[model samples]
Target: MYGLMINELKNVLVAFICTWGLQLLTGITVRNPLTLLYFALFWILGRCKKNEKYDDKKGKMADILWGAASIILSGSVTFFIGRKAVLGFDSGLFRLVGILIIFAGMFLVFVRLKDLPSLIKNIFSKDYSFLAVKGMMQEEKSRKELPFSDLKVLGISAVICFLCYLPYFLYEYPGIMTADSLVQYEQIIGVTPWSNHHPVAHTLVISFFYKLGLAVTGDINKAISFYTVAQMIFMSLCCGAVVLRVKRIVGGIVAPVLSLIFFALVPFNAVFAVTLWKDVPFAGIVMLTGCLLVDMAQKDRGVWSDLIMLFVLLVLLSLFRSNGWYAFLLCIPFMLYFYRDNLIKIAVMVAASVLAVIIIKGPVMTSAGVIQPDFTESLSLPLQQVARVLVNDRALSDEDMELITDVIDTTYIHELYAPDFADNIKELVRAGHPEVIENNKGTYLGLWLTLFAKYPADYIKAWFDLVGGYVYTDFPYDVGNVDGIMANDHGLVPTPLIGGKAVIKGKEILIKLGSFVPIYGMLWCAGAYTWLVIFALIAVLKNGRNKKLAVIMILQAAMIATLLVAAPVIDFRYEYAVVMLMPLTVSICVIIKSEKTAKEY
Candidate 1:
């Protein structure tokens, strides 16, 4: 009894320490006390339920109610707090308090109302039918004969991935034409070797190649070429890794071949792979992380090693883009569903990840002074001036206009200064213009609203428009247009026979068609319309099944749905990273089904 108490205390201490350490490093305050309080309450409730005099069936009912309530309440609180924060309300403190109160009230109600568990059990008893289904699945797997030729499938996948990216080494593909790419290149080649706007991973990769190229050819262009080729090779290897993992799961050679074929044939994949953009790499890391997670779920041995790999992959993924932070959210469903039995371990892992991000982005860079911004005031002055103009119905003087432009240009340079608030403000002013400020404000608000509303269809349409606008105009041939052709306003170029139309029209048609067809397009969309049905069936049929797989599917669905709404006009380039996830998921699902079928036979 004493040992158990000590262990529980130790676990709680570890979670608290890790969370606080990360908060300190990141300089973010958890203003909501209720958040912590709720967690405490939940912990206590769980402990009490475990120690109750009730039988296993009764206690299980209590656990289920607790879980269901937690999910609903957490979602509600997150939604409200997120909205309040976005709208400029300082609700963090209140949110914390409210969560605590809610949790406390719920805990008291559960304690006082002993019949609550029975009520919940009556309401949710049907849900347990899924467990029986899952038991059958396990039995099926046990009865199946293990296949012998799986290794050959993995080998073939490797060969296919290698061949797909070979052209990138032999020929130059004009990289992703984004403002961000230019900034990344500058950071890599510049003497300072850092950019506040860009993440560290891609720049680091580029710098390594630059140095290597200088050693060999002594030409800057050659070095960039080498870097680009290397990035392509690495991306190709990621594709190969996904294919191999898929083969392992599916128990057939076809899965690997299909994954390779789908990946290679994707127009955006081909374009992004040949470029110096980080999207492909980011996608690779995410896929790799997913593969590792699946492995950890299946095999209980060496879990620590698998977890370490996940941590490293997450760090790398985070460094790929500012939005890369969202990738961490993937773990949420996994914890809530699959890792429920290991709550303490999950909490520790989350805390560790938060700390890693803070250390990488904060103190490490702070010591180097690479994040300071000057001209921040100048940047803000224009926004104020622009607001005055708009509100007062006055035109800006030519001098004011010029100052605003100068401020916008210089803001980027000023952001290089780290940790110094004054310098940071100055740089912000220099890099900002009235129009830029307005656009940013609008973009953020739009994104926030879209996510809160969760309108998946509207989100998908907007994303398509954004992609069409960016890629077709920037890189014509990737969408099946001829090279050297200039795309017009709608990302279409005039052709001798076709006159002028969007370059992506053809690609878009195929994407739409493939999305409906089985084993093609992105599996998420292919399965989107039927998602609720599929999920319902899985929940009922697969008991104690690999819960991680189901959680991943849920996360992916949520991510894609969020992307559909919140993503500022999408470019095919941005979509490139997420596209890899779909094929890999499909491969896993197929593998699971095949294994089940074999077992039944």
Candidate 2:
């Protein structure tokens, strides 16, 4: 009893000190709410291993690894917040000591994670009692399950989604178009040469609707409005599909109702639905593709119709964004691994999709005089790494200097250096001397490798800065605040149907809420969604009942990995597919399957 009491006292000290330490690491404040959260986590973790014992050698190694991981995550979040907040972090001994204490506390929490898989498996057991609701739902399929019919429920959800987005569309009327949108519009209207930098397929999608509206309405603004309305309808239907699918899988109204709220009422979703970005449609299609994959996987066999649909979707997915194609190709291996029987059909669809992309990108684009994105677009990481070495004044050999000079004028390096974005450096290359690097790839590649070998630390810092926002959970993003299209000469402008301070404040509050609110704010965070995907994958693996869902999870993860490696900005729209996949990922936990299906994995 005395020993237990002493142990309990020691744990209390650990938890308190850790909580205090985390507060110091982030920011020392009297009433920082995160302090309470940290303490509770530490205390609970301590309780988890109250009497646990392990081999001294293995236990020491495990503790070291987990401790290192915890510190990295915590340190990344701390450093990112510091840089973004622009408050110079105190490099004091107290903060250093605080980090040490934090590591110890966070180690306690992570060490307890060893039991998480078993805990998840037990909680979401193979029996899947939650899914028994499906059988009851099947019995009542003919009968009106709720007061309203299922079709009516679906319509209600979609309409609500449309109606919620109506205000944003009207307020930022026609649609919200960033620089990329305006550039695409220029390509569409012949204001400039057509460039496939902003995926020509998506540009054509806008042009189709815009031109149709122009013919009917004879006003450019109204024509753009036409595309916005169509996009809203499509996105709403996607939300409706989510609602119906969630209802079917969970076999309950509660989960579906909540899912509807998430899809329809979230401010970011509404803003994105009306935003003229390729990512918007790409995200919408990713969800649909994921849903289709889930449906096909369950059948354990494929038909010709399924192959055709998958082929079309894969082609559309690829054409929507260049990265989307890479992600699709990445997913093919996982698909083949799990769904081996359907491998031949999957391969054929993928092959055909690749051929279509090639034809469109090569012959069709070339024939139409559409310019493709420059090779510099794919060199973001290497360029950034090289730029980092220059900006930091890292030691460079004469050969390294010559290689960089060949790519871009060395005099412009300081002026073009942007630690978090590669565009400026890329632009320098484009403006200075792209031809030299383009013509002498081998020399530059050697330079990049040599610099990497010498200044690996700088390369790591450059990567972290570029992608830190996507790695830190609470990183702030101002979504909906950037109202309206960029000032354009083509008569493209915001024609807000409503105007007032109240509307302005309402939008501001909604956008700011992401920073002020806790769980609700997490919805807008790409990093939070990234962790959600990781957690969902863990749950699926532990329960071992949703390998098909796991396939989709891996696909989402692959897409995120692509973003990490080559993404220019840590934009919410870029990671929006995983953000929108939240409800679907949750459904993976409760997907109904027979004993045979579960065992097949």
Candidate 3:
């Protein structure tokens, strides 16, 4: 017992040291104490003897060495692939290297056969037996006979979600509460008008109704009405799909009910469902994709259909917002790591999708704009800047950080940053505005260099801070009102009372009570923390060892991390999909646990 305790302590120490090292190396700042607490738990459990049997010193040594090597190799391969692609080389070499490293790592981790009694004992120990039993029971219950009428329950849930958002679609009272939504709407108009910046799937969907409404009344307002109604209908459909998917995965009436409550109660969902914002569509698409991917990964069926659907969804997500591309990139590592068996097919699908995107949205389709250059010419520089900020020992002022972020966002020197370059090249091809395009590119390049030369540390600090902020803040914080006491032009309501009063009137109302409520405002945070605990426990206990589910959990967690690092700026609207997923995943875990427990008895 003393030895076991000592080992556990060592594990905890390792986890803490590793986590701190990662924070320093990556320049990530985890603001939430809960996140850190979870990490600590993860480290201790991950190193527990029952979870991992490293009986032989030689084997343990090998495990450590190989694990480190595999990680390094994977990183190196990814870097080479990115570099080769950026440098206009045939990226196939790096792709091959990446594939080889991935396979090698998998073999090192899971392929070696071990048949020791201790290993078997470790796999089915009493410590984990309860969890296993719970998982089994849940699986069995989910598989049990179900009444046909339950399908109707899903429909009802969908209706409820739809009706909840009907008011926004039906009426338009301009106020401060709706300001963000209006800004998004205006942004859409600026980009794609009528068709808007919504995911192509959503915009196409709205366009269909708008055209129909046009034929009936030929009025923009009526067309907008049709668009709004379609959004509500589609959102309802998304909710229904979520309910059905959760029901199938978890089983029981409780699962669906809980899922409904969780999604329904979120203020973001309620408010944004009616407003014409891209978040609803983005959430719907991501949720649908997540459900499909989970089903495909877990069930081992519908591979082809799921892949096709995923492709379509990816295109829609990408077109919805630039950030959608991150979702697509995320899938690559997941497939490589967890679905290695389906690599060839997944690769084909991914390649085809990429080709389609390039062909459709490539320079050929849109008129190229003039190129601009800035001081942050190399990608490495921005990354270095990020590293500096993350590792900064001193405290930073809000203004200093904000200035750094603005610079980083504009001149990261990536292809995506060259917004005007394509336009310029197109004009040059047409012999129109050639000088303007060249000059624009020079101007951008010069500005980027100036920033790099003048404020390198500040630039780096901003990059890290931005990434850190995203990783840490599960909820939106008022940037203009840091310390939760100041007010600025960013237009966040000055106080809960004022913001609520502007939206809802009545002196007796508790306008921002949800912010303080345990189950309301903090639900997402709680759910996230709970998921980490449950997932780590399950992985340790060897309960419900479904690789697909594990992969999904890992991917979701990683995506959240990536989003934090890459695009930390989140509104309630932006995080709605993630918010909804938390409760759903937790409910599934609970069902699995309960069922497994019941079986044990």
Writing each residue's lDDT as its tens digit, candidate 3 over 270-336 gives 5556555566677777677767766776655447888899789777766665456665666667666
Error of 3 at 299 (Å): 3.6
The local lDDT score (0 to 100) that residue 272 gets in candidate 1 is 59
For candidate 2, the lDDT comes to: 0.75
Q: What's the lDDT for residue 190 in model 2?
A: 86
Runs of candidate 2 with Cα error greater than 4 angstroms are 1-150, 590-601
Each candidate structure's count of clashing pairs:
32, 0, 32
lDDT of each: 0.49, 0.75, 0.50
TM-score of each: 0.52, 0.77, 0.55
Candidates sorted on lDDT, descending: 2, 3, 1
Worst 10 residues of 3 by lDDT: 479-488
lDDT of 2 by residue, 1-601 (tens): 1344466668777767666545544553423346557766666556545434666989878868877886676566545553333233344653454445545544544555654454446456653332232333343333333456668777998999999999998899988988999998988888899888998999999999999999999999999998999999988887877777777666555568889989877898988888899988888888788778777866867888877888888888888888888988898777777777877877787778889978988998999998988888888878898899998898877867877776677786887788878888888888888878778889888888888899999999888778766766545456556788898688877889997999988887787666543345567778777777887787777665657668878878888889888988667888988877778788776553333344443
Which ten contiguous residues of candidate 2 have the minimum total lDDT?
A: 127-136
Q: Ten consecutive residues with minimal summed lDDT in candidate 1?
A: 473-482
Residue 503, candidate 2: alpha-carbon lDDT: 95
Query: 1 or 2, which is superior by lDDT?
Result: 2
